[model samples]
Every structure is written in C-alpha cells, then in structure tokens.
Target: MNYKDYYKIMAVDKTASQDEIKTSYRKLARKFHPDVSKEKDAETRFKDINEAYEVLRDKEKRAAYDQLGSNWKAGQSGFTPPPSWQDQYQQGNGNFNAGAGGQGDFSDFFESLFGGGFGGGQHAARGRRSMQGQDSNAKILIDLQDAYTGATRNFTLQDQVVDQQGRTQTKDRTLKVSIPKGIKPGQKIRLKKQGQAGVGGAPNGDLYLEVGFNPDSLYTIEGADITTELSISPWQAALGEKVKVPTPTGHIDLSLPKLISSGSKMRLKGRGLPCKVAGDFFVKLKIVFPKSLSTEEEALYQSLKALATNSDKNIEDEA
Candidate 1:
C-alpha cells in the first residue's frame, strides 16, 4: 500500500468545492478511461484519478484527510505518525466504516491516519444479517484478446486482515482466476466463501471481482464491437484495392470498394470480441493528403484540375 495525495491526483486546490472536484474528475475520467484513451498507463492513471475522487468527493473523508495538513507528501516512507493525530475527533457510529466498500482501493497510510476498521465483524454486519465477515473486492483488467479466447490470470491481492495483536495488517495472497469468455467491464464475479474470516463460527461473506479492459493502443471497444480509425492516402480511397488492416488478433487483408468517399466506414462481420452473439469491427477511413507534393505529382494534379475534374465534385454541388 502507498500514500497518495488526493488533491494532486485530481489537480485541484485543497479548498476546492464539491462541484470543482466533480468537474475535474469528469474531465480526467474521460481522458483516462481505458475504453477510449490510447495514452500509455491510462488504466493506472485512471485508477489513481478514481481513487482521488473517491476520497475528496466525500465531505467527511475529505475533511479528515485535510486535517493531516498539506505538509505530508505522498509516498513518504518511514515517517512516524504523530501520537495525538486522532484526539481531535472521537470515533463515531461507523460512518467511516460504512465507506470502506465503496471507496477506491485505499493505502495503509490512509487507513492508519483515519483510525477506523474497514473490515471484520462490522463490515460483515453491513453486508448480510447472518454473515459475520467482510466482503472483499478487487478489480481485474484483462486484454480484449483474452476475452476472445478465455484466459487464466494469476493475481496477488494485498488485503487488510486483523492479527492477534488486534491491529490491522495487510496480507498478500496469490491465486489464479479463470476469465470466462464474453465478460464485460463493470460486471462482478462473485466467489463464495473467499472473503474475510467469520466471527464465532458465522458464515463468511463473499469476494467480488470487478472486470475491466486493458488500455489498448489500436482499438476502442464498445460492448462487443471494436472501432479504429485508419489513415488512407487520397489515391487509396479513390481506387479500391486490398489493404492490410490491424485487428486485436492480427493484421488481415481487407478489400476496399472502389471510389469510397473519405470518412466512409467499413465493417467486418463477426471480427470483434467473442461472445454468444459477437459484434463487428468498424474501420473508419480518413484521407491523409501529403503536406508537400512532388513536382511530378503537382503537374499531374494541375493537369487534372485543368481537365475540369473539380467540376464533377464541387463543394457547392455536394451541398
């Protein structure tokens, strides 16, 4: 677990209003969303943004975090906490505990600074009447290729657990998970009896794993369909030919119809993510003209212009 500066993550002033926080979050969220963004480390950056928003958006949590003073830097290791940190506020009726489930994966420094139990008997009580153990959750990000062909993923989880000293300690556990074909983001896969331990022989709650997609450079996924923009030379659009296009699986030769207009989209049936009923992949053509043409090319264009080729495709006529 690492210490994170929520204010820096959201790029907001410490005294920023709720609306400002929300606006910043929305902007950053869209920029870093794995589905649409092509930036490197988009998923990690998006998770950090979500984690920041999770704490700062909440009034109580924000206030508590603010009390730590702006002097503390993120990722400051081995700094001993002040003894009288929590003396200003007494632990109340578990409002802080209530937030554990929804809050983004928090760090050890955050939990220690806040001074409340996020798991154990109290968490179990909140989930179900008979359960006496907390429900742990983790998010798994997989590539679109993995979804097409199911995969076995090995993940190590750092979970907070209570020790004999009654102090909370983070324990690491590794397990291999089977990613079923056709799983989508935001869907949770529940594993029964895999959560925290129960109190007094009570039944333990379940673990929920949320699914997400890895940030891909060449594809934008929507449901099962994949969309990618392809830049084509002017001649390629004018004269139909076989072109090589990249898919998540591999590059394949696709036939382009002759005289296709710029911005025309071509679809490949059943070439997207695998599902019970799979979707199509769409390639949108974008005509890219050279910034500077060669002398011969210019002469040819001038001749074509003189031949009244422009007469057939005037902007006004199209309009």
Candidate 2:
C-alpha cells in the first residue's frame, strides 16, 4: 500500500495537542465528508483522511509509526535491504513482535522487510497435528508515547531447524510491522503467511504477536482511562489554585479544588485513549510537605499549630 502522510492529511503538526488533532480532524472531516462535499473522488480522499487520522490520532499506533524513522519516502524506488537485515534493524525495546506483520494484508515490500508469511490453503488442512511444523510466536513492548500516537516497528525473528544430518541450526529473519493506535497490553497481532514454511506446501501456521508496555509511563492505564499521581504542596491543596499537571497528552494547567486533601482525585473528561467516546484522565493528588522549613515558615506553622486542636473527649472527661 502507498504510504499516507497522516500528519499532512489531518493538516496538523506531528506535535499537535490531542485537542488540536481532534479539531483538525473535525474540520477536514466536514470539508471532505461524503455527505456534504461536492468534490469528485471526495469519498476516496475522505476515507484516506479518516484512515490516516485513525492511525495518527492514536498513541500506540503513532508511536509505532515514529519508530520507522522519516527516511523512507512514500513510493521511492531503488530499495535494497542488506543481509541479516532483520537482526540489524529489529526493534525490541518495548517487546514488539516482528512476527505479527506476517498475518497482515501488506505489500511485498513490507513482507520482504519483515520476512514471514501465512500458510496457504493446503497448509491449513494439515492442522496442528503436523509433526514437523511448529507454530511461531513473538512479543513486542511499546512506549506510552507510541501507544498514544501509533507507531511502526521493525524486528527480526530466528527459528532453529534440524536438518537431515541430525544437526540443529538457526535461521534468522526480520520484518517491519505497524502497530495500531490505542492498542492495549495483552493484545496480539497476527501476521498471515508469516511463519515457518509448511512441509510439501501443506501450509504454514499463523504468527502471533503479544503486545506489552514499557516502564516510565507518565500515566498508568486502567481499561480505557489513564491515571497519574500528581504531587502538590500543602498550600496549593489548602488554597485552590491552578497548577501545571502532566498527562500522556502533555502538561496542562489544572484547576484544583480548594478543599482537596492528600489522596484526593480529579478527572479530565474525554482526555484518555481516542476511542469513540474517548476515555477520561484521572489525577490522584499527593500532598507534599516541605522539608527544613525556614524561620518565617516555622513561625507560620507554629501559629497554625497553636490554633489547631485535636479533640480527645474520653481523656478530657477522665481528667
């Protein structure tokens, strides 16, 4: 398939905010919306735009795309890959399984880069009972950014085979795969015809890829929504004020409640994954105390302590 510039189609910067992306999508979607547009080929162009937006607007998919780098121009010819190319360029940083690309409906270029294929009609009949052939599996880990923005990845897979000589050997291969936006952990990608060759053309089993997330994620995902702990000083929580809080989408000014206490939770509506209705972003408050208070600060604390009292009715009555 021809490469589609999702950023260009949406008319937004690659670094555009989630809100900006949404806004750009809405505007373009309206302009090219099949129902309202009068331009010829509007339907096809609109679909392309929608598809591009679908991939670019999502975090996971976008991240995969970013990993592919910006060197390859769409439809540029004179392409040649090196020997043991899969090992040299395979991306395993976030547990991205290169084998998953085998099952997808990709072009020869993509298949050659990744190096696997699904079984043919003849092979499917052999079933799992086929003694010689073994099913292949792979796993890929992706960063939180890639999950939010979508991404393309490259990887290499190796399989060991025992020849008629009774000696075991390893064969290495590689591939490029696209990870869709917003794909969650534990999800698997299947690549057709991207596995070990079937015996006597019996057909090959499908390659399965398991998805995982990396550490150091700014927000922790729970289902559709994302959660993050935000640290605030005691004064900020006691007196409601605007503070910059970090989210997967980036930092934004948040208006905290004046009465918020440590462990209090706040939510940003419709700011999580880019699903149909979209998910929410939840911020859990963590109040921090300043260490080594200054003399002025100590005076203020002492005054406040003098005015604060804890009731001990039982002890008081006994006394």
Candidate 3:
C-alpha cells in the first residue's frame, strides 16, 4: 500500500498537540463535508479527512503511526509498516474501527495497517447467532467545567445493525447520559443494553461513551489537574499583585509572589475537577510587555537598563 501522511492531510505538523489536531479537523471537516461543499472532490476529501482524523485523534493510533518514522511520504512506492507493527497493534487494545461497524470509506493503506475492513464483519458473522449485540462506541465532547461539575449531555449515535431478515441497516439513536464529575479523557462510560440489538433474544450489548473535552481557549486538562496561562504586566510580575483569576469553579484572588519570573506556576488547591479527591488548578505566569511604549514608559525603561548596566559593571569591578 502507498504511504499516507496523516499530518499533511490534516495540514498540521507532526508535533501538533491534540487540541491543534482537533481544531484542524473541525475546520477541514466543515470545508469538505460533502453535503455542504460545492467542491468537485468534496466527498473524496471528506472521506480522507475523516480517515486521517480517525487515526490522529486517538492517542494509541497516533503513537503507532509516529513509530513508523517520518521517512515515508504520501504516494511513496512500496511502502509498508514495520514487521512488528501488526503484532504490536494486535497485542494492544487499540480500536481499529475507523467509525461505526468499521465500515467507513477508508483507504487501502488504513486497512493494511489496522485491518478493520470486511474482516471485522466476517468475524462478527461467525458468532452472530448466539452473540449479544456488538458494543457500540462513540465520543462525547464536554466543556472542562462539565468535568468539574457533572453534566447531562445528549448524543446521537449512528449504528449499523442486522435486521430480522439479515439485512444490515443504519440506525440513528439519541441518548441522554449523565456525565459524572471528574471524568477523565479516554475513560469509557458504559450504558447497559444501549448497543445494537442481539439476535435470538440474547441480551443487547452495552454502549461505551468515551469522554473527551472540547478544546477550551482558557484551560488545558491533565488528569484531574487544570492549567491555564495567567498573563501579567512586567511590573505586576516583578512587584507582585493580587489578581482575580478564573478557575474551573469560579474566579478567585491569586497572590503572585514578588520577583516571580515568567513561566512560574501557582497552585490553587482543591480548585480543579471535583473528583473523589479534588485536584489542583495551576496558573502558569506569563509576563507580558506593552507592544508600544509611551514616552514616559520608554524613559523609565532606559533608566532601569542604565541602572542594571551600572550594577553589572560594579559587580565586575568588585570581582
């Protein structure tokens, strides 16, 4: 199979963060979403974007892809995954399904790597008679605050199921689920009997909802902890100040220590996600200077520079 550069397809760098990948996917998905686009290759591009996102969005898949190295490019001839690639993935619990029922219109390259084309269906068919309904998987995007304080979210899941006559059909089901406080990303919230219906009156499979946070402009989550940048003026950082900072719970007065440098962090205990034990909220200090200095500001800066230069000379002389 030919090599496909997923990062290039998504117009992101290989080092792009999860948030950046999500942002790019949203922007491109809208532009080429087939139903909404007037472009000639809208359908094809849409499929490609989804295929790329299917791998890139997941941490495990992205890691496996990265292990393949950066030597291969799109349309590279005679490209193949490493000899141990299949074994590594098979042993791991990586979900190879690109989407519902693993029936997405993915490329041969993807199928070769992950092996979830017709093979998945064939495997399902073998034990179809006595098996319970296949477990359904879907993602729910919630705000960071939703994790702090539990929320009720509604999700529409599209699933493929076999009908009574053995014809496969697509069905859309809506579910309203309660998200528990402090739910971490990649954690599955299983809903019993909400999956595809089973044959022969067997019990229905459960639905697994993966918790994912929507990209927030102000905050980033790490486990139960939340981090955000606190921009302060140079004087405020140097002189220290009591600033009102926003947290997941609410706004609070944060005391910045005197002589605190840029990139320093202040921890607010018990302000993070309210799990069994509350996590801490962290504020990374960022000292910001005025883009343009006024006449008085310029004079003050020059005076400070002169004093610093003189101090350095005095120290040198004393040494």
Candidate 4:
C-alpha cells in the first residue's frame, strides 16, 4: 500500500485547521465533480480529494495520520504504519462513511492506518521475523444486564480469506464470545487468531469486538451509571413515601422526599453497574395522577379549597 500525503492531496499545509481543510475540499469537489467538471480524471481526483479531506478533517484521524510524520512522501509505495499506531487507533468499521468518504471509498493507505477498511486491517508484517496477521475490529451489542453479569454469545463475522486463485474474499465465520463482567461501553474484547490466516505458519491476526449496549425498554446506561424511571402516585410524591422500584440488579425499597417533583432524580450510591469504582444508581420519579375524582373526594377537595382560601385572605388582612 502507498503512503497518501493527505495535506498534499488537498493542497493544504499539515497544520491547516478543520475549517480550512473543509474549504479546500469544497473547491476541489466542485472542480472535479463528475456530473459537472470537464476534467478528464475528474472522478478519480474527486475520490482522492474526498479521501484526503476524510483524514485531514477529523482531529483524531488527522492526528493518527500525522503520527506517520512528514518524512513519508505522498503516493510513496509500500508505506508501513508505525508500530504504536494500531494501539491508539483501533477504529471500528462500525462507521465507515461517517467521514468525508460518503461512499466508503478509501485507499489501502487509509485502510492500513485506520483499523476498519476493505483490507480487513491485515497489513503484512514486513519487518517482524514471525509474520503476525493483521487484527480486525467489529462491534457487538449486548444487554445492559450483561454489564452487571457477563454472558456468552455467538456472532457471525465477515472474514477475509485467500482462495485458490490468490484473491481475497469474504467468508462467514462464527465464534462464541464471552462478554466480561464490568465491561463498559466502547470497550473491546480481543479474540486470538479469529482474523486472517497467516502465511508460512506465522501467527494469525486477532479479532476485536467493540462492546455496545442494546437499547433497553426500562433502563439506559451511561458509563458505569444506570438510570430507570420510578413511577409513584401524586399523593406519594407530595407526602414522600417508600416504594418498591425495579433496578437492573433487583427490586429495592427507595425512599421518596416530600413534595418530590415529577422527573426529579434520587440516587443510590453503589447501586449502578459493577466496576472498579462502582457507578451509582439513579431513580427518576414520574408522578401519576388519577384520571377521575370520586364524588366524596370532590366534596373533600372543596372543603380543603375553602380552608386554603380563608388562609390566603387572613394573610391579605395582616398585610
């Protein structure tokens, strides 16, 4: 794979700001837009411009690219990424087109630097004695309960395989994965040798599964903390009462403050997802009022209204 000088591609300095980079992209895009441009290689130039903007526009991707340093010339063949680059940027293919490449059109150079791309993140281990297959990344959605108590699940992944014709092709591969307890969102699980096969009995690349929580009907997770709505009657909210509320862990009696407002939150420390620090549990109050009033209840409400009116009039008299 060749090294792509993103700055050179966009005709901008390496230190150009995001706004400047975007401005350059617009100009180049308009000049090379296949639909309107008269340039001979408009489409190819447009894709290159888009690819350059894709890397240079984002702070993280740009920073990762810059780490290769200015020593590498643009379009230089067989550009090898630095050793520590992968450790920092295990970017998942989960969002391919979120960047400037709207069509998932990126060069092998882009794919080699960024973990997720058509290359399956397996660049040849050119320098190492024992060839190590390139590691690949994919995302997995697990239940919030799995965070508290881990569970094992099976997943089907698209893996790159070399056929008899010496061509790379995708094949469906299944593997059972164990979701660890206390694993937070955005964390990754590394499964050994689950990726591309290595040549000459070299070590196979590993597969990384990025962890994500499935949307739950009753709960939402952020970091180690978890939140759930606790329903209570208007009277209970007004007078403060102990109520049984459901949590991810289990049911617990939660005390409500007097005159608690609807949507107000009460927190129970250490009741959230288990971790090194243990996130706190939060209960959001939802006050429900009866749709109808009984005849006797209406009569009692009238009496209370009279008393409240008299009290207001007394205050006015005193003033």
Candidate 5:
C-alpha cells in the first residue's frame, strides 16, 4: 500500500486554516459525491475526498497525519509505514468511528495513523503500535562570518526508511537550516519533525545540529570571544603606527603602541558577538623581519649593531 497525503487529496495547503480546509472539502465532496456527479471515477474520488476530510477536520488527527510529512503524494504506490509501526494512536476506549456524514470507510493510511482496533466497540487491538520517534543529532560546520552575521546553510543526510517490501533502505534527505547570529561553537539548533518518523502517527522526533566553526587560519572563536593574529613589521613594533587590520566583519585602522612587543594584545570591547553582553575581540601582535635584506637595509642594521657594541664597551669601562 502507498502512503497517502490527506492535504493533497483535500486540495489545500498544509498551512490552510481549518475553515479554509472545511470550505474546500465541501466543494470537492459535492462535486464527486457519486450520486449527482458525472465526473469519471466519481465513486472512488468521493470516498477518497471524504476520507481526507475526516482526518483533516479533526485537529489531533490532522496533526498526527502531518507527522508523515508531505512527501507521500497521492497516486504514489509501493510504500507503507515502517515495520515497527504499532496500533496506539486511538487511546483508551476512544475510537476512530467518525467519517464524513457520519459514514464512510477510511483508508489503510488513516487506519495506520489512527487505530482501526475497534470492531463493534469490542477490544480488537490488531496491528502495530505507535510511539514518538527517536531524536537525532548531527554536527554542522559554519564560517566565521556566519558567527558574526546570521546565515543559512544546507546539509544532506542519509535516512533509513522501510519500503513496501519490508526492507530498510537509505534515502538522501536535504535540509536548509538557519544559523543565528552570535551562535558559538558546540551550540545546537533544534529542528522539529525532521528526524525519524513516529510509528503509527506519533509525531516524529526532533533533529539537533551542533554548530562548529569551519577551519580558518586567520581567526578563532572561544565562547563569545573572537581572536585573530595581526602580523606587523619590526619597525612598526618599535615606532608604532596606524595599520589596517582585518576583523570578522571587516577591516579597521588600529594604532600600535610604541615599543610594543610581539604577543601584545589589543582588544575591541563589545565587538565579539551576541550584540548584548558581547564578548571582546582580541588582536595579538606578531612582530617579524625580512628573511633577506637589501644592501642599504643591511648597512643600516650593521651600523646599529656597531653602535650597540661601542655603548656596551663604554658602560663596561665606566664600571
């Protein structure tokens, strides 16, 4: 048997209001009521329409049917609920006897979601049971800019489903997720009904995505704090000057203190993230020299070395 999409059968969007659903169902039902309609397949269409209306009109039943997802299209075959499906949706003595006009046979799909376990109101619990699906988790890597500014990301996964032949198969499922601004590594985002489908109409489990930063050589994030290294020339460290530095959001001019040493840090308060209780952005200085110097540059360094040597000798003699 194939999974049926009640929303498609009712010719209404899944988001349609209950009144809208009822209005559409009436029009469709009257057109193919099998008594006054001349449309082909009127009898079959009438039953199908009524069946869909019965489920959609009830809030709890509609919500449970929605757990099956909209992927199950009308006229599609060779699909059924998982083998683990059980009969448990109709609780206590509650029964699914309601149908359009108080009379109409329900489909197997409906029975699966709502138990068909009542025969003349006697206890006839025959079929698989129902329960909430197991929650699932995954890790997602995002860019540094994503942390600074909210962004969207897409991910694909292999999910297990039972085919009509009672065998489990893997299918590729893609999801587009939103990454909120100021989200830190190790944080998780919850997606409802994106995990394993609940058995026999129980709501599907939630999916949680743990966020992490994509590998970047220039910057790193810890908690809400952001840190990056700024390379500077030896002269810039000694003389101090304004330099353009790269930040997560953009570049900005930063002044270095004179005689600043390598590993010295400069901080931008409330620039890290969250936009409230914001962390600080730290720029660590790294002073470096040219591997090969020009002749004039080499001469300047040589003179400085000689002057340093003379000064040390004079100090020693004075002592």
Candidate 6:
C-alpha cells in the first residue's frame, strides 16, 4: 500500500493545534467541495480533505498515524506498516471508529489501517448476529416562505454501503418529503427506515434532517416573530398616514402614529408565521429623505427654517 501523509495533505505542521488543523481542513474542504467548486479535480481533492480530517480529528487515529514516523513520504509505493503494527493495533491500543457514515470516502490505506472490525479493532469471538443499520443525519435548506406555509420538497440523499465483498460504495436515493408549516430552523424531521440498509434483513436505520432557512432579503426571522424594514418620507413621520405594509400572509394597511421616529416599530398582531400560536409581524420605520431636492422643494425647506428662526427670536425677546 502507498503511504499517505495526512498532515501534508491538510497543509499543517506536525505541531499544529487542533483548532489550526480544523481551520485548514474547513478552508480546503470549501475550496474543493464538488457542488460549489469549479476546479476540475474538486471531487478528488474533496475526498482527500475529508480523509485527512477524519484521521487527524481523532486522537487515537492521530496517535497511530504519528507512530508511522517521517521516514515514509506520501505516495511512496509498496510501503507497508511495521511488522509489529498490526499486533499493537489488535491489542486495543489504536481502536477507533468513524462517526456515523463518515468512513465512506476514506482511502484503501486508511481502511487497511483502521477499518478492520467492530470499533475498528479485531472482531469479537462471539457468534455473529444480524444488526440494525446505523442512523444518518443531514441538513436541508428551505425558503422562509416554506415555513409560513406547508410545502412538498424533493431531496436526493447520498448513502454509503458496504457490499458483500467488503467494498464501500455510494448510493443515491431520492425522497419526496412534506414540510409541515411552522417548522422552525434547527428543528429536525425524522424519516423512518430511510437510512443505510440493515444487515441480514434487520430493520433499516432512520434519517434525521435538520431544517435551516435560506437568507431572505425582505425579512428577518426571530423565533416566531418576523421583522421587516418600512421606508417612509420625513413628512410621513411628522404627519401620520395610513400606509400599506407587506406581511407574510399579505399586505395590510398600517396607521403610522404622528411624530413617529426612525427605528420605531409597529406591531401587526397575528400576522407573522402561521404556527400553533400565530406570531406578530413587526415593521421597523425608516425615515428616508429624497436623494436630491428640486428648486421648489428647497424653497419650502427655507421657509420652514425662517419660521423656526423667528420663533426662537421671539422667545429670546420675551425673556
């Protein structure tokens, strides 16, 4: 097997801290993520980054890898572990298991070193029995409007499975899911029997999807409350008026109280998200001045300034 230098792959020094290693791994992972990256070799690079992180992130795996020493370089062909390495690992000194289905994209070298049996150690001597598959977790992004109203969503989930020949393979499965109204961010929806296939006809594992919201340009969601900016002219603040304000359900006429200041908020009862208990919609007033004033508009502003000056002089004379 070829030797793999995980530290070199992550571009981190041997003495790098865990936080430093994580930062580097995340940066490289984003740069090579297949869905977003335009690089030709993004898939391969992404796999490499994941493999490196899987090993280095675990203390047992890192210790085992560090024992391999600096004599062997990455990509060196026909390199094998020391004669006593297997014996040492079998003694329970380097037992490690990947988190959930995170072991899928690892390399042959990693599998040989750490993917032997249950818990990545030698198999137990007890008789084998059918076992249920492991549960899987994933995050799904939805529009803010979807949370306001129930919607149907389609998702393609990628799963990893070990074949009869003990080779890991990836399978894609599509599912149509119904998103219930009032589902908030960080809430999870569970789909039963949708995870990895069970061994020996045992029941399949469950899939848990954590919900997240896509950023909305019009509104900011806070818990059940929704806030939006309402732009109004200076005269509208000085003299109250009824204005049409947009809400999640629809637009409603809002009465702007006289002498309302910029950054003042108006509440629309039961007009936010359609949850078990409806949330309030808030409109934060923003006083906007005209970008440029016409000659006629400028004269009006001058007249107001003279009136204010005359009123101040009259007060001084009375004093």
The numbered model that scores best in TM-score is: 5
For candidate 1, lDDT tens digit of each residue in 68-153?
65545545767544565555432443455423322234445555665453333455234222224446679888888888778998
Q: Write the per-residue lDDT of candidate 4 for residues 1-319, one digit (tens) a residue.
A: 7777779889899778888887787678768966457899998997788777766766666775686765345465777776655655654433332233332345667656754541233322221112234466799899998889988989888765667986667888888999988888999999999765553356676888999999998988899998998779977997898899888877988888899899999999998888888999888889887888999988987997999899999999999
Per-model TM-score versus the true fold: 0.54, 0.53, 0.57, 0.58, 0.59, 0.58
For model 1, the superposed segments whose C-alpha errors exceed 4 Å read 1-132, 309-319
Query: What digit string (tens of lDDT, one per residue) describes model 6 on residues 14-112?
Result: 999999998897688658866557999998887777778877887877887897755334467887766776777644542465432232346778766
Off by over 4 Å in 6: 1-127, 162-171, 313-319
Those runs of model 4 whose alpha carbons end farther than 4 Å from true positions after fitting are: 1-130, 160-162, 165-170
Q: Least accurate stretch of 10 residues (summed lDDT) in model 3? A: 124-133
Expressed as tens digits, the lDDT of each residue in 74-155 for candidate 5 is: 4568666644334444444254534422124556766665545332232223212333454677888889888788989898
Better of 3 and 5 by lDDT: 3
- Distance (Å) between predicted and true CA of 139, model 3? 2.0
Please say which candidate is ahead in TM-score: 1 or 4.
4
C-alpha RMSD of candidate 4:
13.3
Cα lDDT for residue 81, candidate 2: 43
Residue 131 in model 6: lDDT: 35
lDDT of each: 0.72, 0.64, 0.76, 0.74, 0.74, 0.76
Backbone collisions counted per model: 0, 48, 0, 0, 4, 0
Better model by TM-score: candidate 2 vs candidate 4: 4
